[model samples]
Target: MTCFAERAPAVVACAMALLLTACGSDGPAVVEPPQETTCNGVATSVRMLAPFESVVLSGSSAACFALAGGDREYLVIPQLTGELLPYGGYGFRLGDPSPAVVARAADTTSASIPSLSAEQIFGDQVHSLDAQARLDALMRRREQREATGVHHGAEQPTLSVIGVPPEPDTMRTFSVLNTLGETPGYSPVTAKLRYAGARVLVYMDTLATSALSTSEISAMGAVYDASLVPAVMTAFGDGSDIDANGRVIFLLTPTVNALVTASACATSGFVRGFFYSHDLSSTAATSNRG
Candidate 1:
């Protein structure tokens, strides 16, 4: 009885302490405040792209061109950014895809035809064929050209092309792969139509394009979703899912290209050349894989 009496107050005090800890405070649980996302020096123009996030792709001034599809676009941001330091492509005027034309001056020799990877010519970030695997594709192409006396044929060898740069004596016209692998016809004689630049050419296959006016804007959108988007994804993977959503969103805009329709700019006061609108609320069957 003496021992029990001695320990009773101590046990009661311990029980009281446990009860207080379990009860916590009379107010409520504390929560850390949500973090705020801010773009410090982001221009109002770039900031207004969307509420999610954005980045400025910088390197060279915007190279402008008119697409065979009647949509003129420019190279504002590089496709691969830094991985491929000089990321530029041949800008063929709007028609059928063809082999590169090395119109060297009579004084220049065949040895002057500089060789380059297929990716460099076709904009690997948008092309289907992998360049690294086919190192001698250019040689095979030359052989095929010699045998058939044809620059382009049904079996289009895509792996590499002659890296013909702009020279005072060499007026070379390189072919570029459009959305559907068709050429956009003869490329214009531009001073910047060389092997080195900081822009990626974006254009559609001439064969696939119709007389696209503002009325048939939905057709253009369909082409973009079906052909253009998949090509880009194939070229540059799906990219990081920055929004944490299962789908990836790619926002492509030309710093100089004009919007397709007035209706598109109704909501945002401006329109991007191409953008993905994944159905976040839908299932795999209905939702697009951005």
Candidate 2:
């Protein structure tokens, strides 16, 4: 699985104005050469750890692909692997029970399984030991702010103008070709996405919001039917299970940089976005599970 977001010009400018700098495989084995017809500019074939299932490449550029046959659709960047990540590549699943394994195609039929894990997207960086210690201190400070009522909750606002459904002229149609040679038998897949637009919620109080971890802020708004719910509550499209599973998609765009150090910001790539696998895995009160 991969999560990728475009690098905004403003964000790139911010990084340039501020100046910032910023997993994977095992065993050699038989590898199938990728087809000349590339999927999303990746000449190399990519494989997922899950069984050969359904897939759909979104948009004409084929920048994103969604893995099917699961409860939630796994939108991924086919170009990236655990180890090698470009500016716009990363992978994680919201409700997937198993760890994600997306890697360059190899004949692993006989060879030991190629190691795989999530990659970072643009602006997404992991905290180092020192950074974590700094974050711990920051969290304590945030707690004090909360005690002083500086962190009072409010309604989350959606970016109504953003993610609007595509019109006929604006909508681009394409077929999803099988990139992974493992599923040669699978037929070509095509789809038309009717975007009713996503519920793009923006946390209003940046000062208070930035103080808390993304998970904490998410709990404040992303949880289903909870107080201060972020998403516009509604049954998606006639209330039917599109994937025949009792689950809905949830994504969190956190400002992880606010909690990290300048060195981390300078070294680690910008973290544009990420999924909440750890938050979902928890059965504790903080878990996003509903």
Candidate 3:
């Protein structure tokens, strides 16, 4: 990542100028603006001062903020409405019970098993144990198991842990290829759809198998809906763009893209943009314009 220290001077200057302009009057003493306004046509006002640009996200009534003065430019989407939709990455599912492995009783009549502690296994230096001491402790545990008729060479129980299954080899391969900057068997796909009356942006790694993995998407839906969606809706309700620059830029992530894919927005068409990068910072820093 590019260090902020390398870009601080320009950012500081732009921020200072923005702050000064926000203070209303140009004198050294800051003048306070009116607390309330009686503008009837539009209840809210969206302002874009120097060194900043406002943009309306395509197909949505959301406003995005972008810094215009610095070389390292990034877009900031305002808060979204409501809680984010739950996201589970390409991993095990929650609340699933682990498989239990049980051993057959060697002698059902003898129901007693010896209980051993750390002191018995490691002597007085349990806290300061060496590798040899650890090995000896493990050997003692093995002996206890052997005494209970649990043979070391016995075939263990085959247990399957209950959870989400592993991703397919195709998906795994695609993930690897994506990291290597190769678009082997899939092309980038994007779509725009309306969910609960709010516009949604969807980007997909459209593959041949049509199998989807949560690992390749973005998880910022709730934040975008809460912050950017309402603002866009308001601005568009009044028939205005959030930013005069016309387009809003968003740093896409795997989790966020996953949310769109899981939602009703994954249908063909409504394509807007291409897949850029999984790293948001790199995407933002390199995006010169929306």
State the local distance difference test value for candidate 1: 0.24
Off by over 4 Å in 2: 1-76, 82-205, 208-255, 288-290
What TM-score against the true fold does each predicted structure earn? 0.18, 0.25, 0.19
Q: For residue 180, what is the lDDT in candidate 2?
A: 15
RMSD of 3: 27.1
Best by the TM-score measure: 2
Question: Which digits, one per residue and each the tens of the lDDT, describe model 3 over residues 196-269?
Answer: 11233323333322333343333444444455554443333432222222222332335333322334343311
CA lDDT of 213 in candidate 2? 59
TM-score of 1: 0.18
Of candidates 3 and 1, the better by lDDT: 3
Candidate ranking under lDDT, highest first, comes to 2, 3, 1
Position 82, candidate 1: lDDT: 29
Query: Where is the poorest 10-residue window by lDDT in model 1?
Result: 13-22
What number of clashing residue pairs does each candidate have, in the order they appear?
6, 14, 23
Clashing pairs in 1: 93-187, 94-184, 95-184, 95-185, 97-183, 118-160
User: Candidate 1's error at 257, in angstroms?
Assistant: 9.6
